[model samples]
Target: LSKQTKDPRKKVRMLALAHFFEGKSRYQIAEYLKVSRTSVNKWVKDYLDYGLEGLEELPRSGRPCKLDDAQLKQLKAYVLDSIDRTEGGRLTLEDIQQYISESFHIEYELSAVHRLLKRQNFSWISSRSI
Candidate 1:
C-alpha cells in the first residue's frame, strides 16, 4: 500500500499505522519515525476521522501571479520581435522593465524582472564586442 502511494507523507502515515497496530506508544512511534509527537497524534486522529483519504496532502494557497499565461506569451513574442528589429538586437534590464510597465501596467523590482526573464528562458548578452 505504501509503495502504491506517491506522497512521502502518506508513506509515513502507513509506517505510523504499522507502529500503531504493533501497540507502540505515540512518543515511541514519533521517535521511530523521526517526527514530532504532535504530528503522530494528528496523523492518528486523521486516520480515525477520515481513513486513508485524510492522509492526503491538502492543496496550498499562495499569491497569484500578476501576469497571466496569455500575457506572458504575448510579452515573450513582443520582446523577441522587438529585439530582431533593433540595431544590436539586445535589450537592457531597465528597458524590459519599462516595457512591462507600459504594456502590462505592472511594476516589478529590478531583481524580480531578472528572475522573470530567467524563468522565461531569456538571458542578457552584451551587444558590444571586446
Candidate 2:
C-alpha cells in the first residue's frame, strides 16, 4: 500500500510506524530519520485501529436476483418442455405468467418470462422440434 500510495510522506510515515512496531527505539528512529517521535506513534495507532483495506474503500449491496433456485428450476422446466399440456399444446408468455400467478400467485411481466427462459438456456426456437 505504501509503495503504491501517491504521497511520498505517507510511505515514509508507514515505514517509520512499522519500524517502531518491529522493536526499533522511537528516539533512534526519529534521530536517524530527523522526524518527531509523536508522528510515528500516531501512524502506528491509526494502522492498528483500521486495517489497510479499511483505509480506502467502496460500498456495495449488490443486485438481488429475480428468481431463487427453486423458482429457477420450475421456470426452466416450463421453458425447455416440448409442451405445456397444463395449458394445452400451445404456450405463450401469458400462459407462463398465468400459471405462476395462479399457482404461486406471483405476478410477473411477460417479458420477464422471456428473460427467465433465456437465463435457463431456452430460446426462441424452431417449433419443428415440437
Candidate 3:
C-alpha cells in the first residue's frame, strides 16, 4: 500500500506504523524511516487517536484564492477569447493583470498573475512557436 500510494508523506506514516506493529522502538522506527522521532510519535499518536483517517493529510487553511471557481473559469474563457484581439495574437502578463484588475476589481502583481496562469495550465510558450 505504501509503494502504491501517491502521497510520499502518507507512505512514510504507513511505514512508521508498520514498524510500530513489528515491536520496534520509536527511535528504531525514526532511524529506519529517516524521519524525526517527534514525527514518528505524532503519527503513532494520530493513528491511535483517529485510526486510518488520521494518517491522511489534514486540510490546510492557507490564504484564500482571490478568484473563486466561477471567476477563474471566466478569466480563462476571457483569455482564450481575447487571444485574437491581443497585439500579435499574444497576451502578455501585463494584459492579464490589467484585465483582472479592471474586470474583477482585484489587482494582482505580475508574479501572482504568472502563478495564476500556471495553475490554469496556460503556458507562456506558444504551441505554434514550438
Candidate 4:
C-alpha cells in the first residue's frame, strides 16, 4: 500500500514476487497479472538487485541532495520559533520563508517555500486578519 510504502512500484513488485515465490511460473504470473513477461522479469530482477524498494522508479535524474534533515529542522525551528511572534503573533509563510532564505545560507525560491510548508501541513493566512 502507498500509505505504508514510500515506493509504489515496489508494492507492485512485492505482489509479483509473492506470487512467483508461491510457485507460480513467470508466464502464469504474467498472464494472470496482465503484464508482459519482460515486465515481470524486470521487476523480479530489480527485486533481487536491491530488494523491494529498488523496484520503485527513482527520480529520473537529479543534481543531488545538498542539505540534510537536521539542517532543515534547524531552519524550520528558526522560522517557526524565532520569527516575529507578538500580539500580531507568528510569522506568515512568506516572512518565515524569507527568514529561512536569509538564515539558512540557502537561496530558496518563494514557490519552494510554499511547497515545503505545504508538505509540512503549514498554511498561510492574510497577515492583516491573521
Measured by lDDT, the strongest candidate is 3
* TM-scores of all candidate predictions against the true structure: 0.54, 0.41, 0.65, 0.48
RMSD of 4: 5.9
Cα-based lDDT for every prediction: 0.85, 0.67, 0.88, 0.71
Q: What value of lDDT does candidate 4 attain over all alpha carbons?
A: 0.71
What's the ranking of the predictions by TM-score, best on top? 3, 1, 4, 2
Counting clashing residue pairs in each candidate, in order, gives 0, 0, 0, 0
Per-residue lDDT value at 92 in model 4: 61
lDDT rank order? 3, 1, 4, 2
Alpha carbon deviation, residue 76, candidate 2 (Å): 2.0
Q: Which tens-of-lDDT digit does each residue in 76-128 have in candidate 1?
A: 99778867774564677888889889998999888888888887898866574
Q: Model 4, range 42-122, lDDT digits (tens) per residue?
A: 888877888756677776785443346876677667756644555566566577667766776676667777777676666
lDDT of 1 at 126: 54
lDDT of 3 by residue, 18-84 (tens): 9999899999999998989999999999999999889999989977789989989999998888765
The residue pairs found clashing in candidate 4 are: none
Better of 1 and 4 by TM-score: 1
Task: Choose 2 or 3, whichever is better by lDDT.
Answer: 3
